[model samples]
Target: MSQQTKSDYVDDVDVDDDWDDHPTDDELEATVENLEASGFDVEVVSDAEEALDVLVSEIPAGASVMNGHSTTLEEIGFDDYLGEGDHDWENLAADIWSIDDDAERDAARRAAQTADYFLGSVNGIAQDGTLVAADLSGSRVGAYPFAAQNLLLVAGVNKVVEDVEAARERLHEFAYAFENERAQEAYGVESYPSKELVYRQEGTEGRTTVVLVEETLGY
Candidate 1:
């Protein structure tokens, strides 16, 4: 058998060709209105790099920050910046993983959920302003409900679907497969969406912020 190489799994691998679909202007306007009406603050960014710049300004200095596993986050350079950038915020994920002991690492992960800022990406966004996401484990989505002090979700405009049913299909058609590819490459195992989270509404006035990028990015 040929030896498996990073290039074989990641470089030349085929990704789904569904980005040809672009939402109309009416669709974008309505989706943004619906998202805001649903009580979540929404900001539309022009491109991935611009999204990164805006995100940095949005996060407060010296805040404790924790982020979930998200391709979008990596796409926008958050993963690299947060890990290596000389910033005032505490890198909770780095701190958690640095613990050599497995039990202590797990405990740190749980505690990090309550960080001042919890950043992540969502799989789907319904035109009605609903946010949909899933996780292989509860560690990621677990803090969105009420634990984290603040939440930041960055997604591409392509993730905006017609409705909740379409959102589910979006997950099955794109998010799951893309994530599985990443998991297989990184861990040598497949991944499934075991836990689901539908953010229907945000009761707090400014607790949740949604950054929507115009360019096609992530799954």
Candidate 2:
């Protein structure tokens, strides 16, 4: 068999021709509004870079922040910009299941529990404003609910689907596959556990905010 090089893999990839089935701008606008009505604060942006700027500006100083493990956010350079800031922010960027020391994991959980704001990405969000996420490590979804007083979700247009059914399909078919690849590349782990098992974790009561960018952001 021929050895598959990076360029060879890239060259062989076929793009999905699903654009023709995409909804119109008016439909998207109505969907956004409906999302807001369903108890989610949603903001629409033109691009990933703009979304990052808006996210940083919206967070106040002296606020603790928690981040989800998201390749999309990293691709857009959120960590670089966030690291440059001189605010009271705590980073919860650890593998959910690989914490060897209980004390260390406890400290990380405490930081998240006390954060003033939390930032993460959603696997999929429905037109009616339901946020969907699949996790193997409970960190990302676990910290979402009560980890902070305020919650901010950064999502790309690629993360949006028609409804819950489509969201679930994307989760199993696309989101999980991409997440597995990411985890392997970043942490050297191939598999963790059932995505459905991790999805059972729920966030605590907090003001949830979402920023949806027009461009593709994450898996």
Candidate 3:
């Protein structure tokens, strides 16, 4: 995964008119520092492999792990890893999807909100250290505020924005569109942000960890 400049994603990053402008290395450094200062433990990795390694080693072997629909995770091979990789932790998503009954499957998905570890991605991250995410339902973001014991978010650097407002714009312009397209194809309906979560600051120490990768991943 190359550290593509903002120019590379000129057509895709629609956080706003100027939101597509990618930050420089200095801006990235500042963003990391700002993120850490705001109480989010941050990890700066160069590529998807490093990001996967971080997830594999940081999460305990037997700690129940779960994740939602994330293209970034898919791109990094995490979906397959959680399903097929040798590990001791329970993969809740697999469990939720395995149920033969639709009603039971929906229940399991809700139950997963309390998993030992909840993993997901964000729509955008602000330089001020705020995280912005949206979903058709609150199933994923619902765990971030209080449901999960520990939370891990894997995001590509392309998500970093200049400010909180830009973060929201990115979600509306880019993330929502990308997801709506996927939803229409997958479920025969368009998707919108039925539920939104803005992670302000984590009060607990070491409870929420964010892995920031340098490559262009996700919407």
Candidate 4:
């Protein structure tokens, strides 16, 4: 399947004009430095394809993989790749969704958080190295903070904010409206920022990697 592009739904929602601008080179450099100092490995990619390539190459064969719902992931083709593309890793998302029993499926989701690799995207990333993310459910941000063995977050440069407070503001004032429209269009329901996560630092070294793409993507 072809990857879903931002152009499909971007025009349908009201995105904050302030949130759409990419960071300056100096800003990007500072963000990267702070992220690395906070114990996350940083990867800067020129485009979505390179971001997808880096994401794919980070995990080894036979590793168990799971991901939360992320428009950014879909934009970069990771969702389709993990679901239908040729890959050697154990795709836990596929397995969990195939279950017939609701109870079992819910249990699988909780357990899958500890998969060898957990991938998703954040709503806002502070220049000071803080990451802000929220979801209608805790499915995505839940795995980001120590639940997963390894975390891989992919985001556009537009997500970078001035500080943690601004990151949080961006989540509600900027990302939520766009995400709400997306939820309505795709699932026939509205989305809310029900659960939030503010990631300041990683205690374990090399456990998380943030891939920042040059192009704007997702909410």
Candidate 5:
């Protein structure tokens, strides 16, 4: 299947555009500080290229890597990079997709949660340092809380919100609409927030990193 960009679904979805605006410098800095205080290693990048570079530099060679569906990663060119880039890491996503049998492929997906590095994007980020994301199935969030040995979350500043409640509102009212439309277009199936995760703090040290790009990206 071909990769779809945000432009492919943006016109079909109705959402409050304000939720997709880049945060002010003060808001960004405060959010970074709070995220750090909450035990999440936060990296602020000026643009998508810088974010991609940081993402690439985080993982070591030969490690098994898997990622959930993330338009932000595609926007930054990481999806194509991981799929075709010259890297020694074991691309579990590619491996899982190559499976022919339905049951085997499903099992591979479940087993991939333990991949050395699991990468994905967050739907909403609260300035208070909570990360909110939802998935029609538990595929994406299943690795975020603790399943994966390490997690890499890449998101644009547009995802930042006032608090956990605001984050959830953004997810339910804004991100969900865009995602549902995208799902219908891509998979010919409707999507919903059937599973949601509210991540407040990380107990494991150096196990998770949040890359915040200054540009507006993803839902």
Candidate 6:
């Protein structure tokens, strides 16, 4: 069977700028506080550097860390940051089921299973504190269930959509395109059809802790 391109599989989802009526910082703070009250550990940071500090401190020394293929992580220079830290960190970039190498592929799979902490982004998080995400490669989203002991979701304020429908739209409109671009750049393909897998799963990870950053972080 012939495979489809990303453009062929992804539905047209639009981002409504009207939804950009963001709350004030105080309101955002209160919302975050309420989420914490609901038993979800939440933190808000000003920028990527502070996020790195939080990441360093949250991940204990000697703990194994697994990372998703987060554009935000790459944008924030997490690869370099991980090198400077003393903890054991594994990059799951090659685990997306698209990589052709066997050993690197196996290592990525193992990293997803054995890591103490997993870090990535959410497609959308409701103002009421519900976390929403879509999975394409499955590895990035699949790892959430049994891959890591603790799941840390780092999302930008822009990712906060009004509802799940909006979240899905954002994924098709923004996240999917961004992710596809990265895939093309790395793999020399214009698109990958695996994106249809996104509709197969709900949220990833069992125990999830979300960190909402006010500024733009990841794609």
- The candidate that wins on TM-score is 5
Question: Each model's TM-score?
Answer: 0.91, 0.78, 0.89, 0.94, 0.98, 0.72
Prediction 6 TM-score vs. true: 0.72
Model 6 scores a C-alpha lDDT of 0.60
| Model 3 global lDDT (CA atoms, 0 to 1) | 0.83
Which pairs clash in model 6?
A: 144-205
**Model 1 spans > 4 angstroms off:** 1-16
Candidate 5 lDDT, tens digit per residue, 1-219?
A: 687777787788877888887777898899999999989999999899999999899999989999999989989999899988579899999999899999999999999999999999998999989999999989999999999999999999999988999999999998898888888878899999989999999999999999999898898
Tens digits of per-residue lDDT, candidate 1, 1-219, equal: 222322233443454556325578899899999999999999999998988887788888999999988878887888889988678899999899789999999999999989999999888889999988898887889989888999999988988888888777777766777677777767789888889888899999999999999977666
Model 6: runs farther than 4 Å from truth? 1-23, 30-34, 84-104, 107-111, 190-207
Candidate 4: C-alpha RMSD after superposition: 1.7
Clashing pairs in 2: 145-203, 145-204, 146-204
Candidate 4 positional error at 69, Å: 0.7
Task: For model 1, state the Cα shift of residue 30 in Å.
Answer: 0.4
Top lDDT: which candidate number? 5
Residues 125-149, candidate 3, lDDT per residue (tens digit)? 9998999999988888988888898
Pitting candidate 2 against candidate 3, the one with the higher lDDT is: 3
Q: Model 5, stretches more than 4 Å misplaced? A: none
By TM-score, the candidates rank as 5, 4, 1, 3, 2, 6
Against the reference, the lDDT scores of all candidates come to 0.83, 0.63, 0.83, 0.90, 0.92, 0.60
Worst 10 residues of 4 by lDDT: 1-10
lDDT value, residue 86 of candidate 5: 79
Q: What is the lDDT for 133 in model 6?
A: 60
**Model 6, C-alpha of 136: deviation from truth (Å):** 2.5
